[model samples]
Target: MPATSYLRRLCACLALGLLVGCRPEPAKPLDQQLYVWQRQWRPAHEQALAESRADFSTLRVLALQAQPQAGWSRALVDLSRLKADGRPVIAVVRLDGQLPALDLDVARTQIGQMLADWQAAGLNPSGLEIDHDSASARLAGYTDFLLKLREQLPPGLKLSITALPAWLDSPQLPALLRAVDSSVLQVHAVSNPRLGLFDPVQARKWAERWSHVTERPFYLALPAYGMALLPDTGGVPLVESETPLNRGGERRELLADPQQLADLGHQLRDKPPAHLAGLIWFRLPLPGDRRAWSLTTLAAVARGDALSGRWLVELSSQDGLYDISLVNVGNLDQALPPRVELSAEQCDGVDGLSGYTLQALPQHLVFNRQSSARVAAGGRRALGWARCIRIDQGAWHVYP
Candidate 1:
């Protein structure tokens, strides 16, 4: 090759390298943590806490609540047990609606006293979080309250707040952001589905818009729980229970789809802004909390893994009686057929499920699936039982 030709090729390669370096680098993945908001401390939660400690960098626990009467309702966490593993725990102090309306000095003193009590209990938390859903009208008051609370907090301890999305547009947002060490933008709520809870599209838009305006780092609080909406006498949807409803009024379970969560994770990783801190899950999963996501699903979403649907059917016998159950072991709800038929050669009698209707066929027992009995994700329902006084075979057939 000619020397000039080699030189030209080298120059082109150098130019390409420069262009690549000038282009912006991809955003790093968000380092999100989990929030434990169980009002009643349970022994089982310890395991969940420990597991969370292993997976995430930090855990935020609801430690106290400022009641409407200007008193504190403290959560009883076994600090020794929680801190034994040496993971960081941020104590969250939630202020009820009335606190923002109280006298500034009085509220300040009460908050300070709670911090002192926590220290007295030998829990020197790494951070203290204030959770208040301050009304739109109380933005200034809430801002002032936080500023005062910050001054009372011990030096070297971080102060954080759970912020509503609307606050991102408030005029006082900048001052509030400056007052706190960090903020968690709670992007999920139990509202109507015109816009679903934990909508990734809206979440990404919020993160992009607010991250540029806020001076302090902010984390996104995602939902890991479900809500059951029941209709009232006036045909309005009311929150009936946190758990999935299996009987009575019309119910809708609002759960964040795992795919949407994963997509959001990708968006944050691709172009996360300077003020975008990370993500924090609303509540950790408990063993018997049917409305909450299972630990497996939560972990999968955090890791940005694809979630698949699963169905499980089991039959067990005791004292000449057999019980059938249908379980959803996946992270998405599943629909069942209108009726399921069960048959066995030696089955003597069949009892209908209390919440569903049953029809006897010539060779099988048919159980109808009530509209309300549709199984939710991570939900379990009893299908009915059979009395088998004698059995020539240990086989049963189920048809959907």
Candidate 2:
């Protein structure tokens, strides 16, 4: 063929390839709309806020720094309105005393009154969420306070608490989880450097461990907003402002973005561990140009169509050295098929893993250790839901 003819054919083939690669497009404007959520109310995000209808049934707000009677009063009104519209509310009560921390008796009395006041104002919360940065050292006192608060809490009310991520691995965690009705493990990995980097792989491990240990519904509090890096005069992660609130106060730069948040959320959806209610985007009134991005994501989630299904596969050195458990959200259980064979490539060249055999449980796709060895060393694997799994097998397919 002539050179000109050959070049023309190549161009034609390239265009055809591009067309074929594109998947069927999702809904246009409706699917593309995003919600903006922030810690403080601003006229800027008003449009986004009005448009957002993010599902709050599984959402809980913990207003920690809210103080002053008037501020508290306004917050109560907002909570009341939200509850009237049918949304769950959780007010994080901070202890006023130091050292031994106000006597649990006094603490309980004060918090109870606060709750009563809110209830009287026509804002009936599902329950209270106890939060304290100093809660680590004051675990004993805090635990006592929570236990008492739980007892004093009226019937039909629920109790939950915001736990610092550092405390998740604490020896006291078991007892702490035991005391609360639910736990919102503040796994703010982005904000803390000491724990480690933002490894979604490791996050899967933390989620699995917490779910297994706590055996309670918990909120995955994520930093929808990014952190500003402090100039290191010395060899330390220094900043004019340290905490998220402080960072915002100082007007520092942000590290995470909307695209990043979407990536993180999708990663969690795949094998949503047991009792994994949903995600909480830190505190609201988000500061920055990304406000719309956050709100849009929330609205998508609220619509109950946030694309969810991704897996966390961890491969280790030796078979017995580590565990490769998968939290199954594909609805694969004993009632369905006992065993489904996944090929090596399907297993993604995992040397040890043969296939997956789901348990009777609906929320776990755990991989046995012996079976996991087939997966390649130092490699993790995940399976995305290409299509939705049917709720149940039909009558025409009834077994013998």
Candidate 3:
């Protein structure tokens, strides 16, 4: 027991304590917001907004839009249904991409009237978000338009814009960023429709680059919906979202995976970029929204909760006819099964709908999925009907 041994042990203990003290704490969870893109608010919105309150804290409601020669169209938002409590609300002004020019006079008139209408409804919007997809070459003109619009806005009212990554290459980007109090960098449906709906890797890269350009706080607008591609004679497919075109042809669906978005959010929060404030999920989902995520699934993703999916085959019978449907009884969204099989004593007049084809064999009927389809959490998908004396519900199976 010498003095030298005691000194060595004391020095080792002090070093270990320093190492533990220097370890950084975990990052805080990012804020969550929603884009209420529905032009016509329904009674269902009451329930949706109430359920979303526990997770999301902001609402970017679509207020009005301008067409090429159609002047302006205002959304039929029921102010009473939009009881967002104390959450911040931002009114979004959409400018159609087909417009040949940016008309500040029209914008001033349109936005002023829209704001007055909102005030009449007792909606005190905290900000104005200009949703435009101006070309990269037009950033200079866009910046000028923003500056002019900012002057017309009420004093102390915040101004923001929906930005695209294509503008990242523009030399006048910094000036454009300076014209707004904030920006929402949209990373979905910014490219060719054939490529895909969204790419998390590209989204991350865009956010990192955007952080390097603007000093103002910003948020990322991620997709929580799907789009359908309809075949056209011009070789280019027409993209449909939230609205259905009554054209009669097989359409391919492109959905933004919820799991992918959840993972991206986790990564961004783990190591947030400079001035990156929060996440704004595109197109808040309604109960009957076919191309959007369910409220249960979306809420789980925003809270970074665990995901587990359970799909069950359900059969409803009426007069020797059995209707087959896939029910998602779990809290996780899942891809539709590639194949569905049903055992029956005898079935006739078999058919399939909603992206499936029916194949009838001796004692089993196979519903083969021909395109990509997704089943939302706590949702159902029809797989056609069967005319049989008995449908063996206990023997049905679904194959991925």
Q: Which candidate has the highest lDDT of all?
A: 3
Clashes of each: 0, 27, 0
Error of 3 at 53 (Å): 1.5
Give the CA lDDT, 0 to 100, for residue 137 in model 1: 72
Best by TM-score: 3
Q: List the candidate numbers ranked by lDDT, top first.
A: 3, 1, 2
**Superposed Cα RMSD, model 3:** 3.9
Worst 10 residues of 2 by lDDT: 391-400
Candidate 3 versus the native: TM-score? Answer: 0.84
Per residue, candidate 1 scores C-alpha lDDT tens digits across 1-400 of 9999999999999999999999986676678688878777778977877766655778898887877664767777776666674767798888786663745676567667766876776767899888888876788878887887778778998999888878766887888888888988888872354345667787778777788778888898988776766767876666643544455875666666667887788777777867887889878877777667777677777877777766665677889887877677776555554666555545667776746666655556667866553355677778777776542232334344
Q: Candidate 2: deviation at residue 76, Å?
A: 7.2
Pitting candidate 2 against candidate 3, the one with the higher TM-score is 3
Name the weakest run of 10 consecutive residues (lDDT summed) in model 1. 390-399
C-alpha RMSD for every candidate = 4.7, 25.1, 3.9
Task: Report RMSD for candidate 2.
Answer: 25.1
